[model samples]
Target: MTMNDLQELFVHKLAQQYYVERELVEALDEMARHTTNDRMSQGFADHREETRTQVQRLEEVFAALDRPAEARNSSVLEGLEEDRRELESRIEDDELLNMVYLNAGMMTERVEMTAYEGLTTLGEQLELGNDVQTPLESNYEEEKSAFRELETLATAKDLKSLWEQLTPS
Candidate 1:
């Protein structure tokens, strides 16, 4: 597709995010399986469900736009997933692995947040109706909430112990 107008750019970005969310559902499941901490594993599992809803919301956005629900490849998300798999293969310590997962989760949420922010801004400028705007806003809010949950876990006592283990006196 040619770069012609803001509407085109909006659809392209939306498609990219749709791909990312779809990929995240599987990635979250894998992360949950690999996590040794019960709490962290459950967190990943819960977020996987949320990601599914986010995917559906993105599809709604496509429908509202009267466009087919399609996905563009997101190299950034693919690279992140690759890096996560490589790190998982190399890290053997459960504590350290949990910490890595925490960091990766936070980083992924940040990327999703940015994507939704841009999409919402574009939606407003384009004056898209509530059908499209509502879903994008809902997804964005969920991403923010999930990020905060991970951030809290990062500061919890268990992760503090992990930090202590990594930092020698």
Candidate 2:
């Protein structure tokens, strides 16, 4: 397909998101195993399951668009996952590592939130109507919720103080 219009752009964006969500599934599982805090680990485990559902939702959207469920590699997600892996390996302190995982989760959710918001907006412009918009909106809302939860976790004393220490005066 030609990269000619908003419709194509929307599909391309959907493909990228599909890739991101699938990548997140694996990343979240790894994070769950690495986190020292039980609650934080459970949160990652839970989000991984949600991400699996989201992948199915994306596939549903592809079916609605009468397009094959295809994924385009997302460098952004790959980089985030790689950075998280590297950071985890370098951090010897359990508390610091938990904070790192929390921060990384928040960063990922923010990226997903932005992507879903854009996809929904593009759906509107493309006149794909509610059929297309609904699933994207659902995913957008879930991402928003995940981001809020991650934000709360990041504000936990250990993470907050660690971030403060890292920030330059």
Candidate 3:
């Protein structure tokens, strides 16, 4: 509560966002290894690098305020973690793997986009301008981009001959 200005809350939310994404960075690491598809594995690996930079940006945000970033777990993250575990078990089948990974990746990116947007709005409400806003906005866009990538990959699915018996419609 010590951050009197709204910009501080923006900083706080950014820090919080950092925590969630940091967790995702870890999850994505495991997810990357689980993926048999070379493209999918590489995608996760590349995103992990981006995620590291995002955490560094958050650290800069914290330093600007002379505060150390303290992480608080967002409860919703647990659900994503559990789903990913389930996903690991299901990935042996090509059909299930593609669809499940696409669906799971899309959902996780959505959660991140939602969380990042919430931070951006909170920043705007507090009269925070471009300096604080820019990085958050970039991160938001990254998640959105990931969402689109998964959708594109989803289009390759076939109903028949695929193990899942479901088409990519």
Candidate 4:
């Protein structure tokens, strides 16, 4: 536990966040593959691509700070992933899957938003300026965008129609 500078502190937090974002990229890919609804699956697929670029940006951040991009295991993301696994195992109905996917997507967005907020604050405290802040804001905006999109389709009608389209049973 070394606190050399505020910039270093942000790097530490960013490292953890970067790890989790990487993990989510893989998890979202799998979730997309499992999802029955094309739109829902596409949503996760798009985010996976987004996460890939973000990972590169995170690497740049690490380079700027002269810190190695190390991954601290993120239990927050791990727990959510476990829940996703369990939910998939239990839900056989299409309606259920749609609802569940919406919930899971929302959860991912919230977790990311929280992590980014902390990292952004740390960056500001360290006076990193727009170099770091710009990308973080982009991350924030993307998460919010994804969550709002889910909110629109989380309605009962949308879920029912999607469920019917997805579930053969």
Candidate 5:
């Protein structure tokens, strides 16, 4: 696709988000498997399911636009994933790994939130209507809620203790 107009740009962005959400489904599952903390593991598992739904919603958005659902490669998501792998390789302690996961989860949610925010705004500009806006808004709200939960977990007393213990005095 060429860099032609707003609609094309919107579609490109939407496709990128679609790739992000789809990739997250697998990434979250792996995160859940890696985390020893039960709460964090469960949270990742739950969000994985939500991500699946978000993928479906993105498909709906494509259908509404009369465009075939396609996933544009997201370098942002790729870099984040690469960073995650590098960090995981350097850390062996389970608690510290949990912290990394928590931080990474928060980061991913922030990205998703921003993407959806822009998507919704672009959607409005395109006059795509409720069929498009509703799902995007719902996905955005869910990302916010998920971020709050991860943020809370990141600040919990146990994690704090782990952090304090890990840092050199």
Candidate 6:
């Protein structure tokens, strides 16, 4: 396929998201293991499963477009993962770490939400119809929901004592 217009750009964008979803599955698994908070840990694990479904949906979208279920390298996801690693290494307090992790998740969800929203819009613009747009919109809503959950976790008051307990004397 010749690289030319918005349609081609949209396909490439979807491919990038496909890669991002795969990357996130692994990242979320590791995050689930690292989190001290049970709820947050479970959230990561649940989202890992959701991400797998999201990837399959992306493949379906590609099928509808008569394209291979391909993945392009996602530098954005790579950078976010790298930053997460650095943050984990630097934060010592378990509660603080949990809060930081939730914040990081929210950031990641925002990026995914933005990408899905744009892809949904692009699918509409290209007249790809609801077949493509519907899945993208579904993924967008999932991301949004995840972001809200992360926010609630980030703000919870019960975890504050964990931070204080670990505070340096």
Candidate 1 runs further than 4 Å off: none
Candidate 6 — what's its lDDT? 0.88
Better of 3 and 5 by TM-score: 5
Residue-level lDDT of model 2, residues 1-169, one tens digit each, is 5698788898999999999999889989988998888878998999999999999999999999999999999888989888988987898988888888888999999999999989988988888877788888888888888888887877877667877887799
The true-versus-predicted C-alpha distance at residue 19 of model 1, in Å, is: 0.1
C-alpha root-mean-square deviation, each candidate:
0.9, 2.2, 3.4, 3.7, 0.9, 2.6
Rank by TM-score (best first) = 5, 1, 2, 6, 4, 3
What is the C-alpha lDDT profile of model 4 across 1-169, one tens digit per residue? 7698876677778988889888988888887887877888998899899888888878777777767778887888888888878988998876676677778888888888898889889888888878778888788788788888777767557686765776697
Question: What stretches of model 5 exceed 4 Å from their correct place?
Answer: none
Model 3 / residue 80 / CA error / Å: 1.1
| lDDT, candidate 5, 40-90, per-residue tens | 999999999999999999999999999999999999999999999999999
Off by over 4 Å in 2: 157-169
Better of 4 and 6 by lDDT: 6
- What lDDT score goes with residue 71 in model 3? 74
- 1-169, model 1: which lDDT tens digit per residue? 5889999999999999999999999999988998898888999999999999999999999999999999999999998888888898999998888888988899999999999999999999999989999999999999999999999898899888888989889
- Best by lDDT, which number? 5
Candidate numbers sorted by lDDT from highest down: 5, 1, 2, 6, 4, 3
lDDT of 6 by residue, 46-158 (tens): 99999999999999899999999989988888888889889889989777788777877988999999999889888888899888988888888888988898877766666
TM-score of each: 0.97, 0.91, 0.81, 0.86, 0.97, 0.90
